[model samples]
Target chain A: MSGWVKIAGLGPGNEALVTPEVTAALAEATDVVGYIPYVARVAERPGLTLHASDNRVEIDRSQHALRMAAEGKRVVVVSSGDPGVFAMAAAVFEALENGPDTWREIPVEVLPGITAMLAAAARAGAPLGHDFCAINLSDNLKPWAVIEKRLRLVAQADFAMAFYNPRSKSRPEGFVKTLEILRQECEPERLILFARAVSRPDEAIRIATLAEATPDMADMQTVVIVGSSLTRVIDRPIGPIVYTPRSTPE
Target chain B: MSGWVKIAGLGPGNEALVTPEVTAALAEATDVVGYIPYVARVAERPGLTLHASDNRVEIDRSQHALRMAAEGKRVVVVSSGDPGVFAMAAAVFEALENGPDTWREIPVEVLPGITAMLAAAARAGAPLGHDFCAINLSDNLKPWAVIEKRLRLVAQADFAMAFYNPRSKSRPEGFVKTLEILRQECEPERLILFARAVSRPDEAIRIATLAEATPDMADMQTVVIVGSSLTRVIDRPIGPIVYTPRSTPE
Candidate 1:
């Protein structure tokens, strides 16, 4: 049989959010590769094999998946959210670029899924309705200085901001510093949303202001959205809705 | 029956891209409302009514949806991509904020979808794998000055950029000015991907550099992606893959 590799996204921990294209890819795959949690998300079958690796080894994992596909195996690399957003699609391309030219001939496709930022934003009533920037706050691959610089610039641009991998057990102080920067740059009433395990059974959402936001509010599982100056809040008997209007004054 | 409204995203253009959540909403909707084309995507059923409106009347469409839902109808407002991203979710919330307080009691939800940027980025490789910003270039709502200021700051920050509504028949000059600003701010060889009618049968993707790109390359159907300095291109026999790397030097 011919070999092919599909980088697919299982969107934001919700089965309903998985697109039909991604579902078909997983069904036809003989081998699945990804981080431990993501690989565990795929079911085990008679002909299918799952390779679950630890985090921070994306390069190694990409090479392994490429090798399997080059050996005429149908491989699917599963990412938690859209693979193009700080996920496996770029890693696969990076591997293909640095690997043998023969591997480049293999059929490769990146199937999009509902990314975490959009999923989180939808649950919070469209805090990202206006222009926005998505920044991955992990300093593992880059420097914290770069993260700090982008935060300041995004605030200055008045773009709604979505942050991924905000805080982890190893690096808890990063989010604290992030909150401090936002507090200094934005107004005290700037809207902030902390969405945890969105669309999952344990999903929870919290809306707060810059002054009320604390570092402990966000963890690795959380996706934080900071609204622009024009974002509004509506209090209702059911619940409060927060949304950023599409139009802005000149 | 109690009244409710759901603002759902139909994905870029494919039925496969539509989420099961959105499909369920449409299946149970007593009335569906949206732009002419989007409403046409919904299948006809005995108890369902489709309200197709012209462009530039989002507020009117939103208020109509709200009114129907408040009258004890299950209403669904459809948008081409994710409703939270430059779409109807904000419009519905705006209507809710300004309309009668009684309307606020109506149950409302925003269902996310695979946005055009992510869909386009997947079709190309993963040009949005790193830090990225999404900007709507339509001057009909916001000022051209704001769009230019964002382009400059985004280039300065070295974030990959996605431009929606890049060009239309009426506002062709906006894209021309946009290209000029990018040419001045970004390098001549900065990578740009013009993805037209993405995820549709007529989908077309073109990879070009800032110097090689022309304003006519993108129309309203196109979603433009401008890569950061770190973006790379891999040429293969089938096609070229464009992706932004995950890391940058200090």
Candidate 2:
């Protein structure tokens, strides 16, 4: 039997957000591999084996999936959002690059999913409707200097920004510092959104201005979106709808 | 009966890529409004009315949908990709903000989907795996100077960029100028992916570099992705896989 490896995104914690393509891939998989929570999201079928690993073991997980595929096992590696965005697809490709030459022959494909930022953006009107940039705020992979530099430049460009892995138990100061930089660069009335566990039952959305935004508003599960200079807000019965206008006047 | 407006993304031209949430909204929609091609994607059902409008009529289309929803019709305003990302969601909100106070009482929601850039990135490996920016290249709504300024700053920020509406028959010069600007700022070997009609049967992805890229390589159907300095490519039997690694050296 021919074997292949498919890197798929499960989207942001909602079964309804999972694409039909991903569903079809899961049904055809002989083995599923991913972080514990992501792998848990997949059901246990009679013929399917689940390999759930801890976080920060992306390379190891990638190699395991690659090895399984090399041994003629149909494997699916899952990531919470789009696998191509800060997820397993890059790690899988990195594995393929460093692994044995035979691994190159394996049929690998990446199925896209509704990413966290987009999901969060949808839940909170359309703050990201105009030009935007997405930055990973966790300083684990990159230095704090790099993060600070990108934040400053993104603000200078006046792009609405989405921040992933903004604050964690170990990295609380980063978001605080992020707020400081935005305060320095952006206007006090600049809109910021804190969307936590988006599309999940615990989903909570908070819209605030730069002056009112605090670091404590976001955790690891939250995706923070800061609007561009042109973002507007409309008050209604349900809540305020924030969106960046499509046209920028000369 | 309280009426509501749903600005939903249909994903990038694939039935499987459309979310179940979007599918459900379409089924429930008493009136569907969107660009001609996008509206054609919906089936002709007995009770559903499809209001197909031409391009450059976003405000008009949005107002029409809002009007219908306010009059007790379930209206779904569809965009090709995620409605929040350079699509229709912002337009709908802009209309709401300018319309009468009664229109503000309507329940408006933005349903996210797999955006074209993410879909294109998934098809060609994780080229957008790291920090990235999305810019709409159409000068129809924004000034060309703003677009040029953004291109320069974004390149200096060392971000992978996804350019939507890269080219069209009427405005070919913008993409040509964009290519020239990119060539000036980016490295000669910087990777560029022109993904046309992504996720559709006629989908075509061409991998190029700053030196080899041409304006004629893209059309309105294309989404152009320019990788950051760190983006890498891996050759395989199927094709080359391009991705940007997660970590950066201190």
Candidate 3:
């Protein structure tokens, strides 16, 4: 085993797309720790020690994995997208910081992997053409007031934004406020892209105008791309495509 | 052959991670046209007709592919990253849009794949944690006057920036003006990330200050990430890690 344990992002979805290096790590890890579905990504690995838990247990789960690593065990902390993009890497560090003195010496190596924002941008025909931001409307960690203020400020800046956690069953009303602010400062026809289950089997990607997109089309499983003023959406007979050019000079 | 043909993005590097559906498309196509490097992404198949070309022949290459598709050939147009992100898909559309009347009947599909911005962000510890923009400094088609205005607006907007094609051998003196402008507007302590040939074997990823990341450290092959004012460079004894968090309400 490598001296330091490696926490790798397997990208957004589908295990088959996982790199050979990540696959090899999964095959050899003494334990693979992640949320239930994320841990299931490596379920087929022969003779694996799986530590699957609920989605809300970031701190506790990370602490458990760090303890194993501190004891010199070969553990692989798994994250869906890139390790640090709202993934488990930060939680690992947070846990390590709060761990016992003996565990502070543990070495950690983070291997980069593709993230969903780039994946979503890529999937939707370059909706990430210019400046963009990603915000989690989860409200689990931060209040809606903070997210709203940043959205209003960023929307005014003409950014091509990607919205993560735009809507959930409980958060159905959140995107309405977010979109209202975006429409207030942005043009009505600016493209808004929805990339659902990117790189997964039931993939669905579509580009629509901001006025046409609805929350019914998106769930927590979807990542929305609200194009900057430069972003454009074209509807073909086959499907709709979005493009945000680098910039259009005035 | 089917009436429609698929244009695909083969990703920045590594073939094992290619989506199964995309792989099948390449195998099934009777004809495929792409830049040399992109054409080589898929393994050679005897039944497949491979059309490869020189670097600077974008319009001619795309025109040739469309002409064949008009003649009822199942042609797949390929590019390294997503076909539309400063790549071939849009060029193909541009060519098709202006072509002969008979050519309009052919069907086209743009499939999604990974891009370098994503591959770089994934590797660099998700410095793309918030809003960002990507600009290609190559002035082959667009004018520098336009690039400068867009850069200034985005810089003043407080968006994270990813500079693509910052410099090449021909344009050795590029990115200096961009670096200078952004530095003047943002804090000097803001993080500047250099990720070169990301995901490829000889990858060099370094996190530097805005003042430190001069053009000497970059080339056409690099992806530059200019951090937001909120970005923090955590310098562990191992190395520096860039983290830009959602600004908690003051």
List all candidate RMSDs to the true structure. Answer: 1.0, 0.9, 3.7
Docking class of 1: high
lDDT of 3 by residue, B7-120 (tens): 777777666445554677787788888888778776777878889998778779878888888777888888875555667766665565567755556677666556676667
State the DockQ, from 0 to 1, for candidate 3.
0.25
Ranking of models by lDDT: 2, 1, 3
True contacts kept of 1: 0.83
Top-lDDT structure, candidate number: 2
lDDT of 1 at B141: 81
Residues A1-250, model 3: lDDT tens digits: 2335567778888654455567767777888888888888776656668888988788888788877886667788888876766677766665654568555456665655556776776665566645456666666666677677667766765656777778888778998788787778777787887789988988888767778877677888888878777776544554545666543554
> lDDT per model, in order?
0.93, 0.94, 0.70
Candidate 2 residue lDDT tens string, A1-250: 3899999999999999999999999999999999999999999999999999999999999999999998999999999989988889999998899999899899999999999999999888999999999999999988999889889988988899999999999988999999999999999999999999999998999999999999899998999999999998999977899899999999
**Docking class for candidate 2:** high
Candidate 1: clashing pairs of residues: none
Candidate 2 yields a Cα-based lDDT of 0.94
Show model 1 residue runs off by greater than 4 Å: none
What would the TM-scores of all predictions be? 0.98, 0.99, 0.84
How many residue pairs collide in each prediction?
A: 0, 0, 5
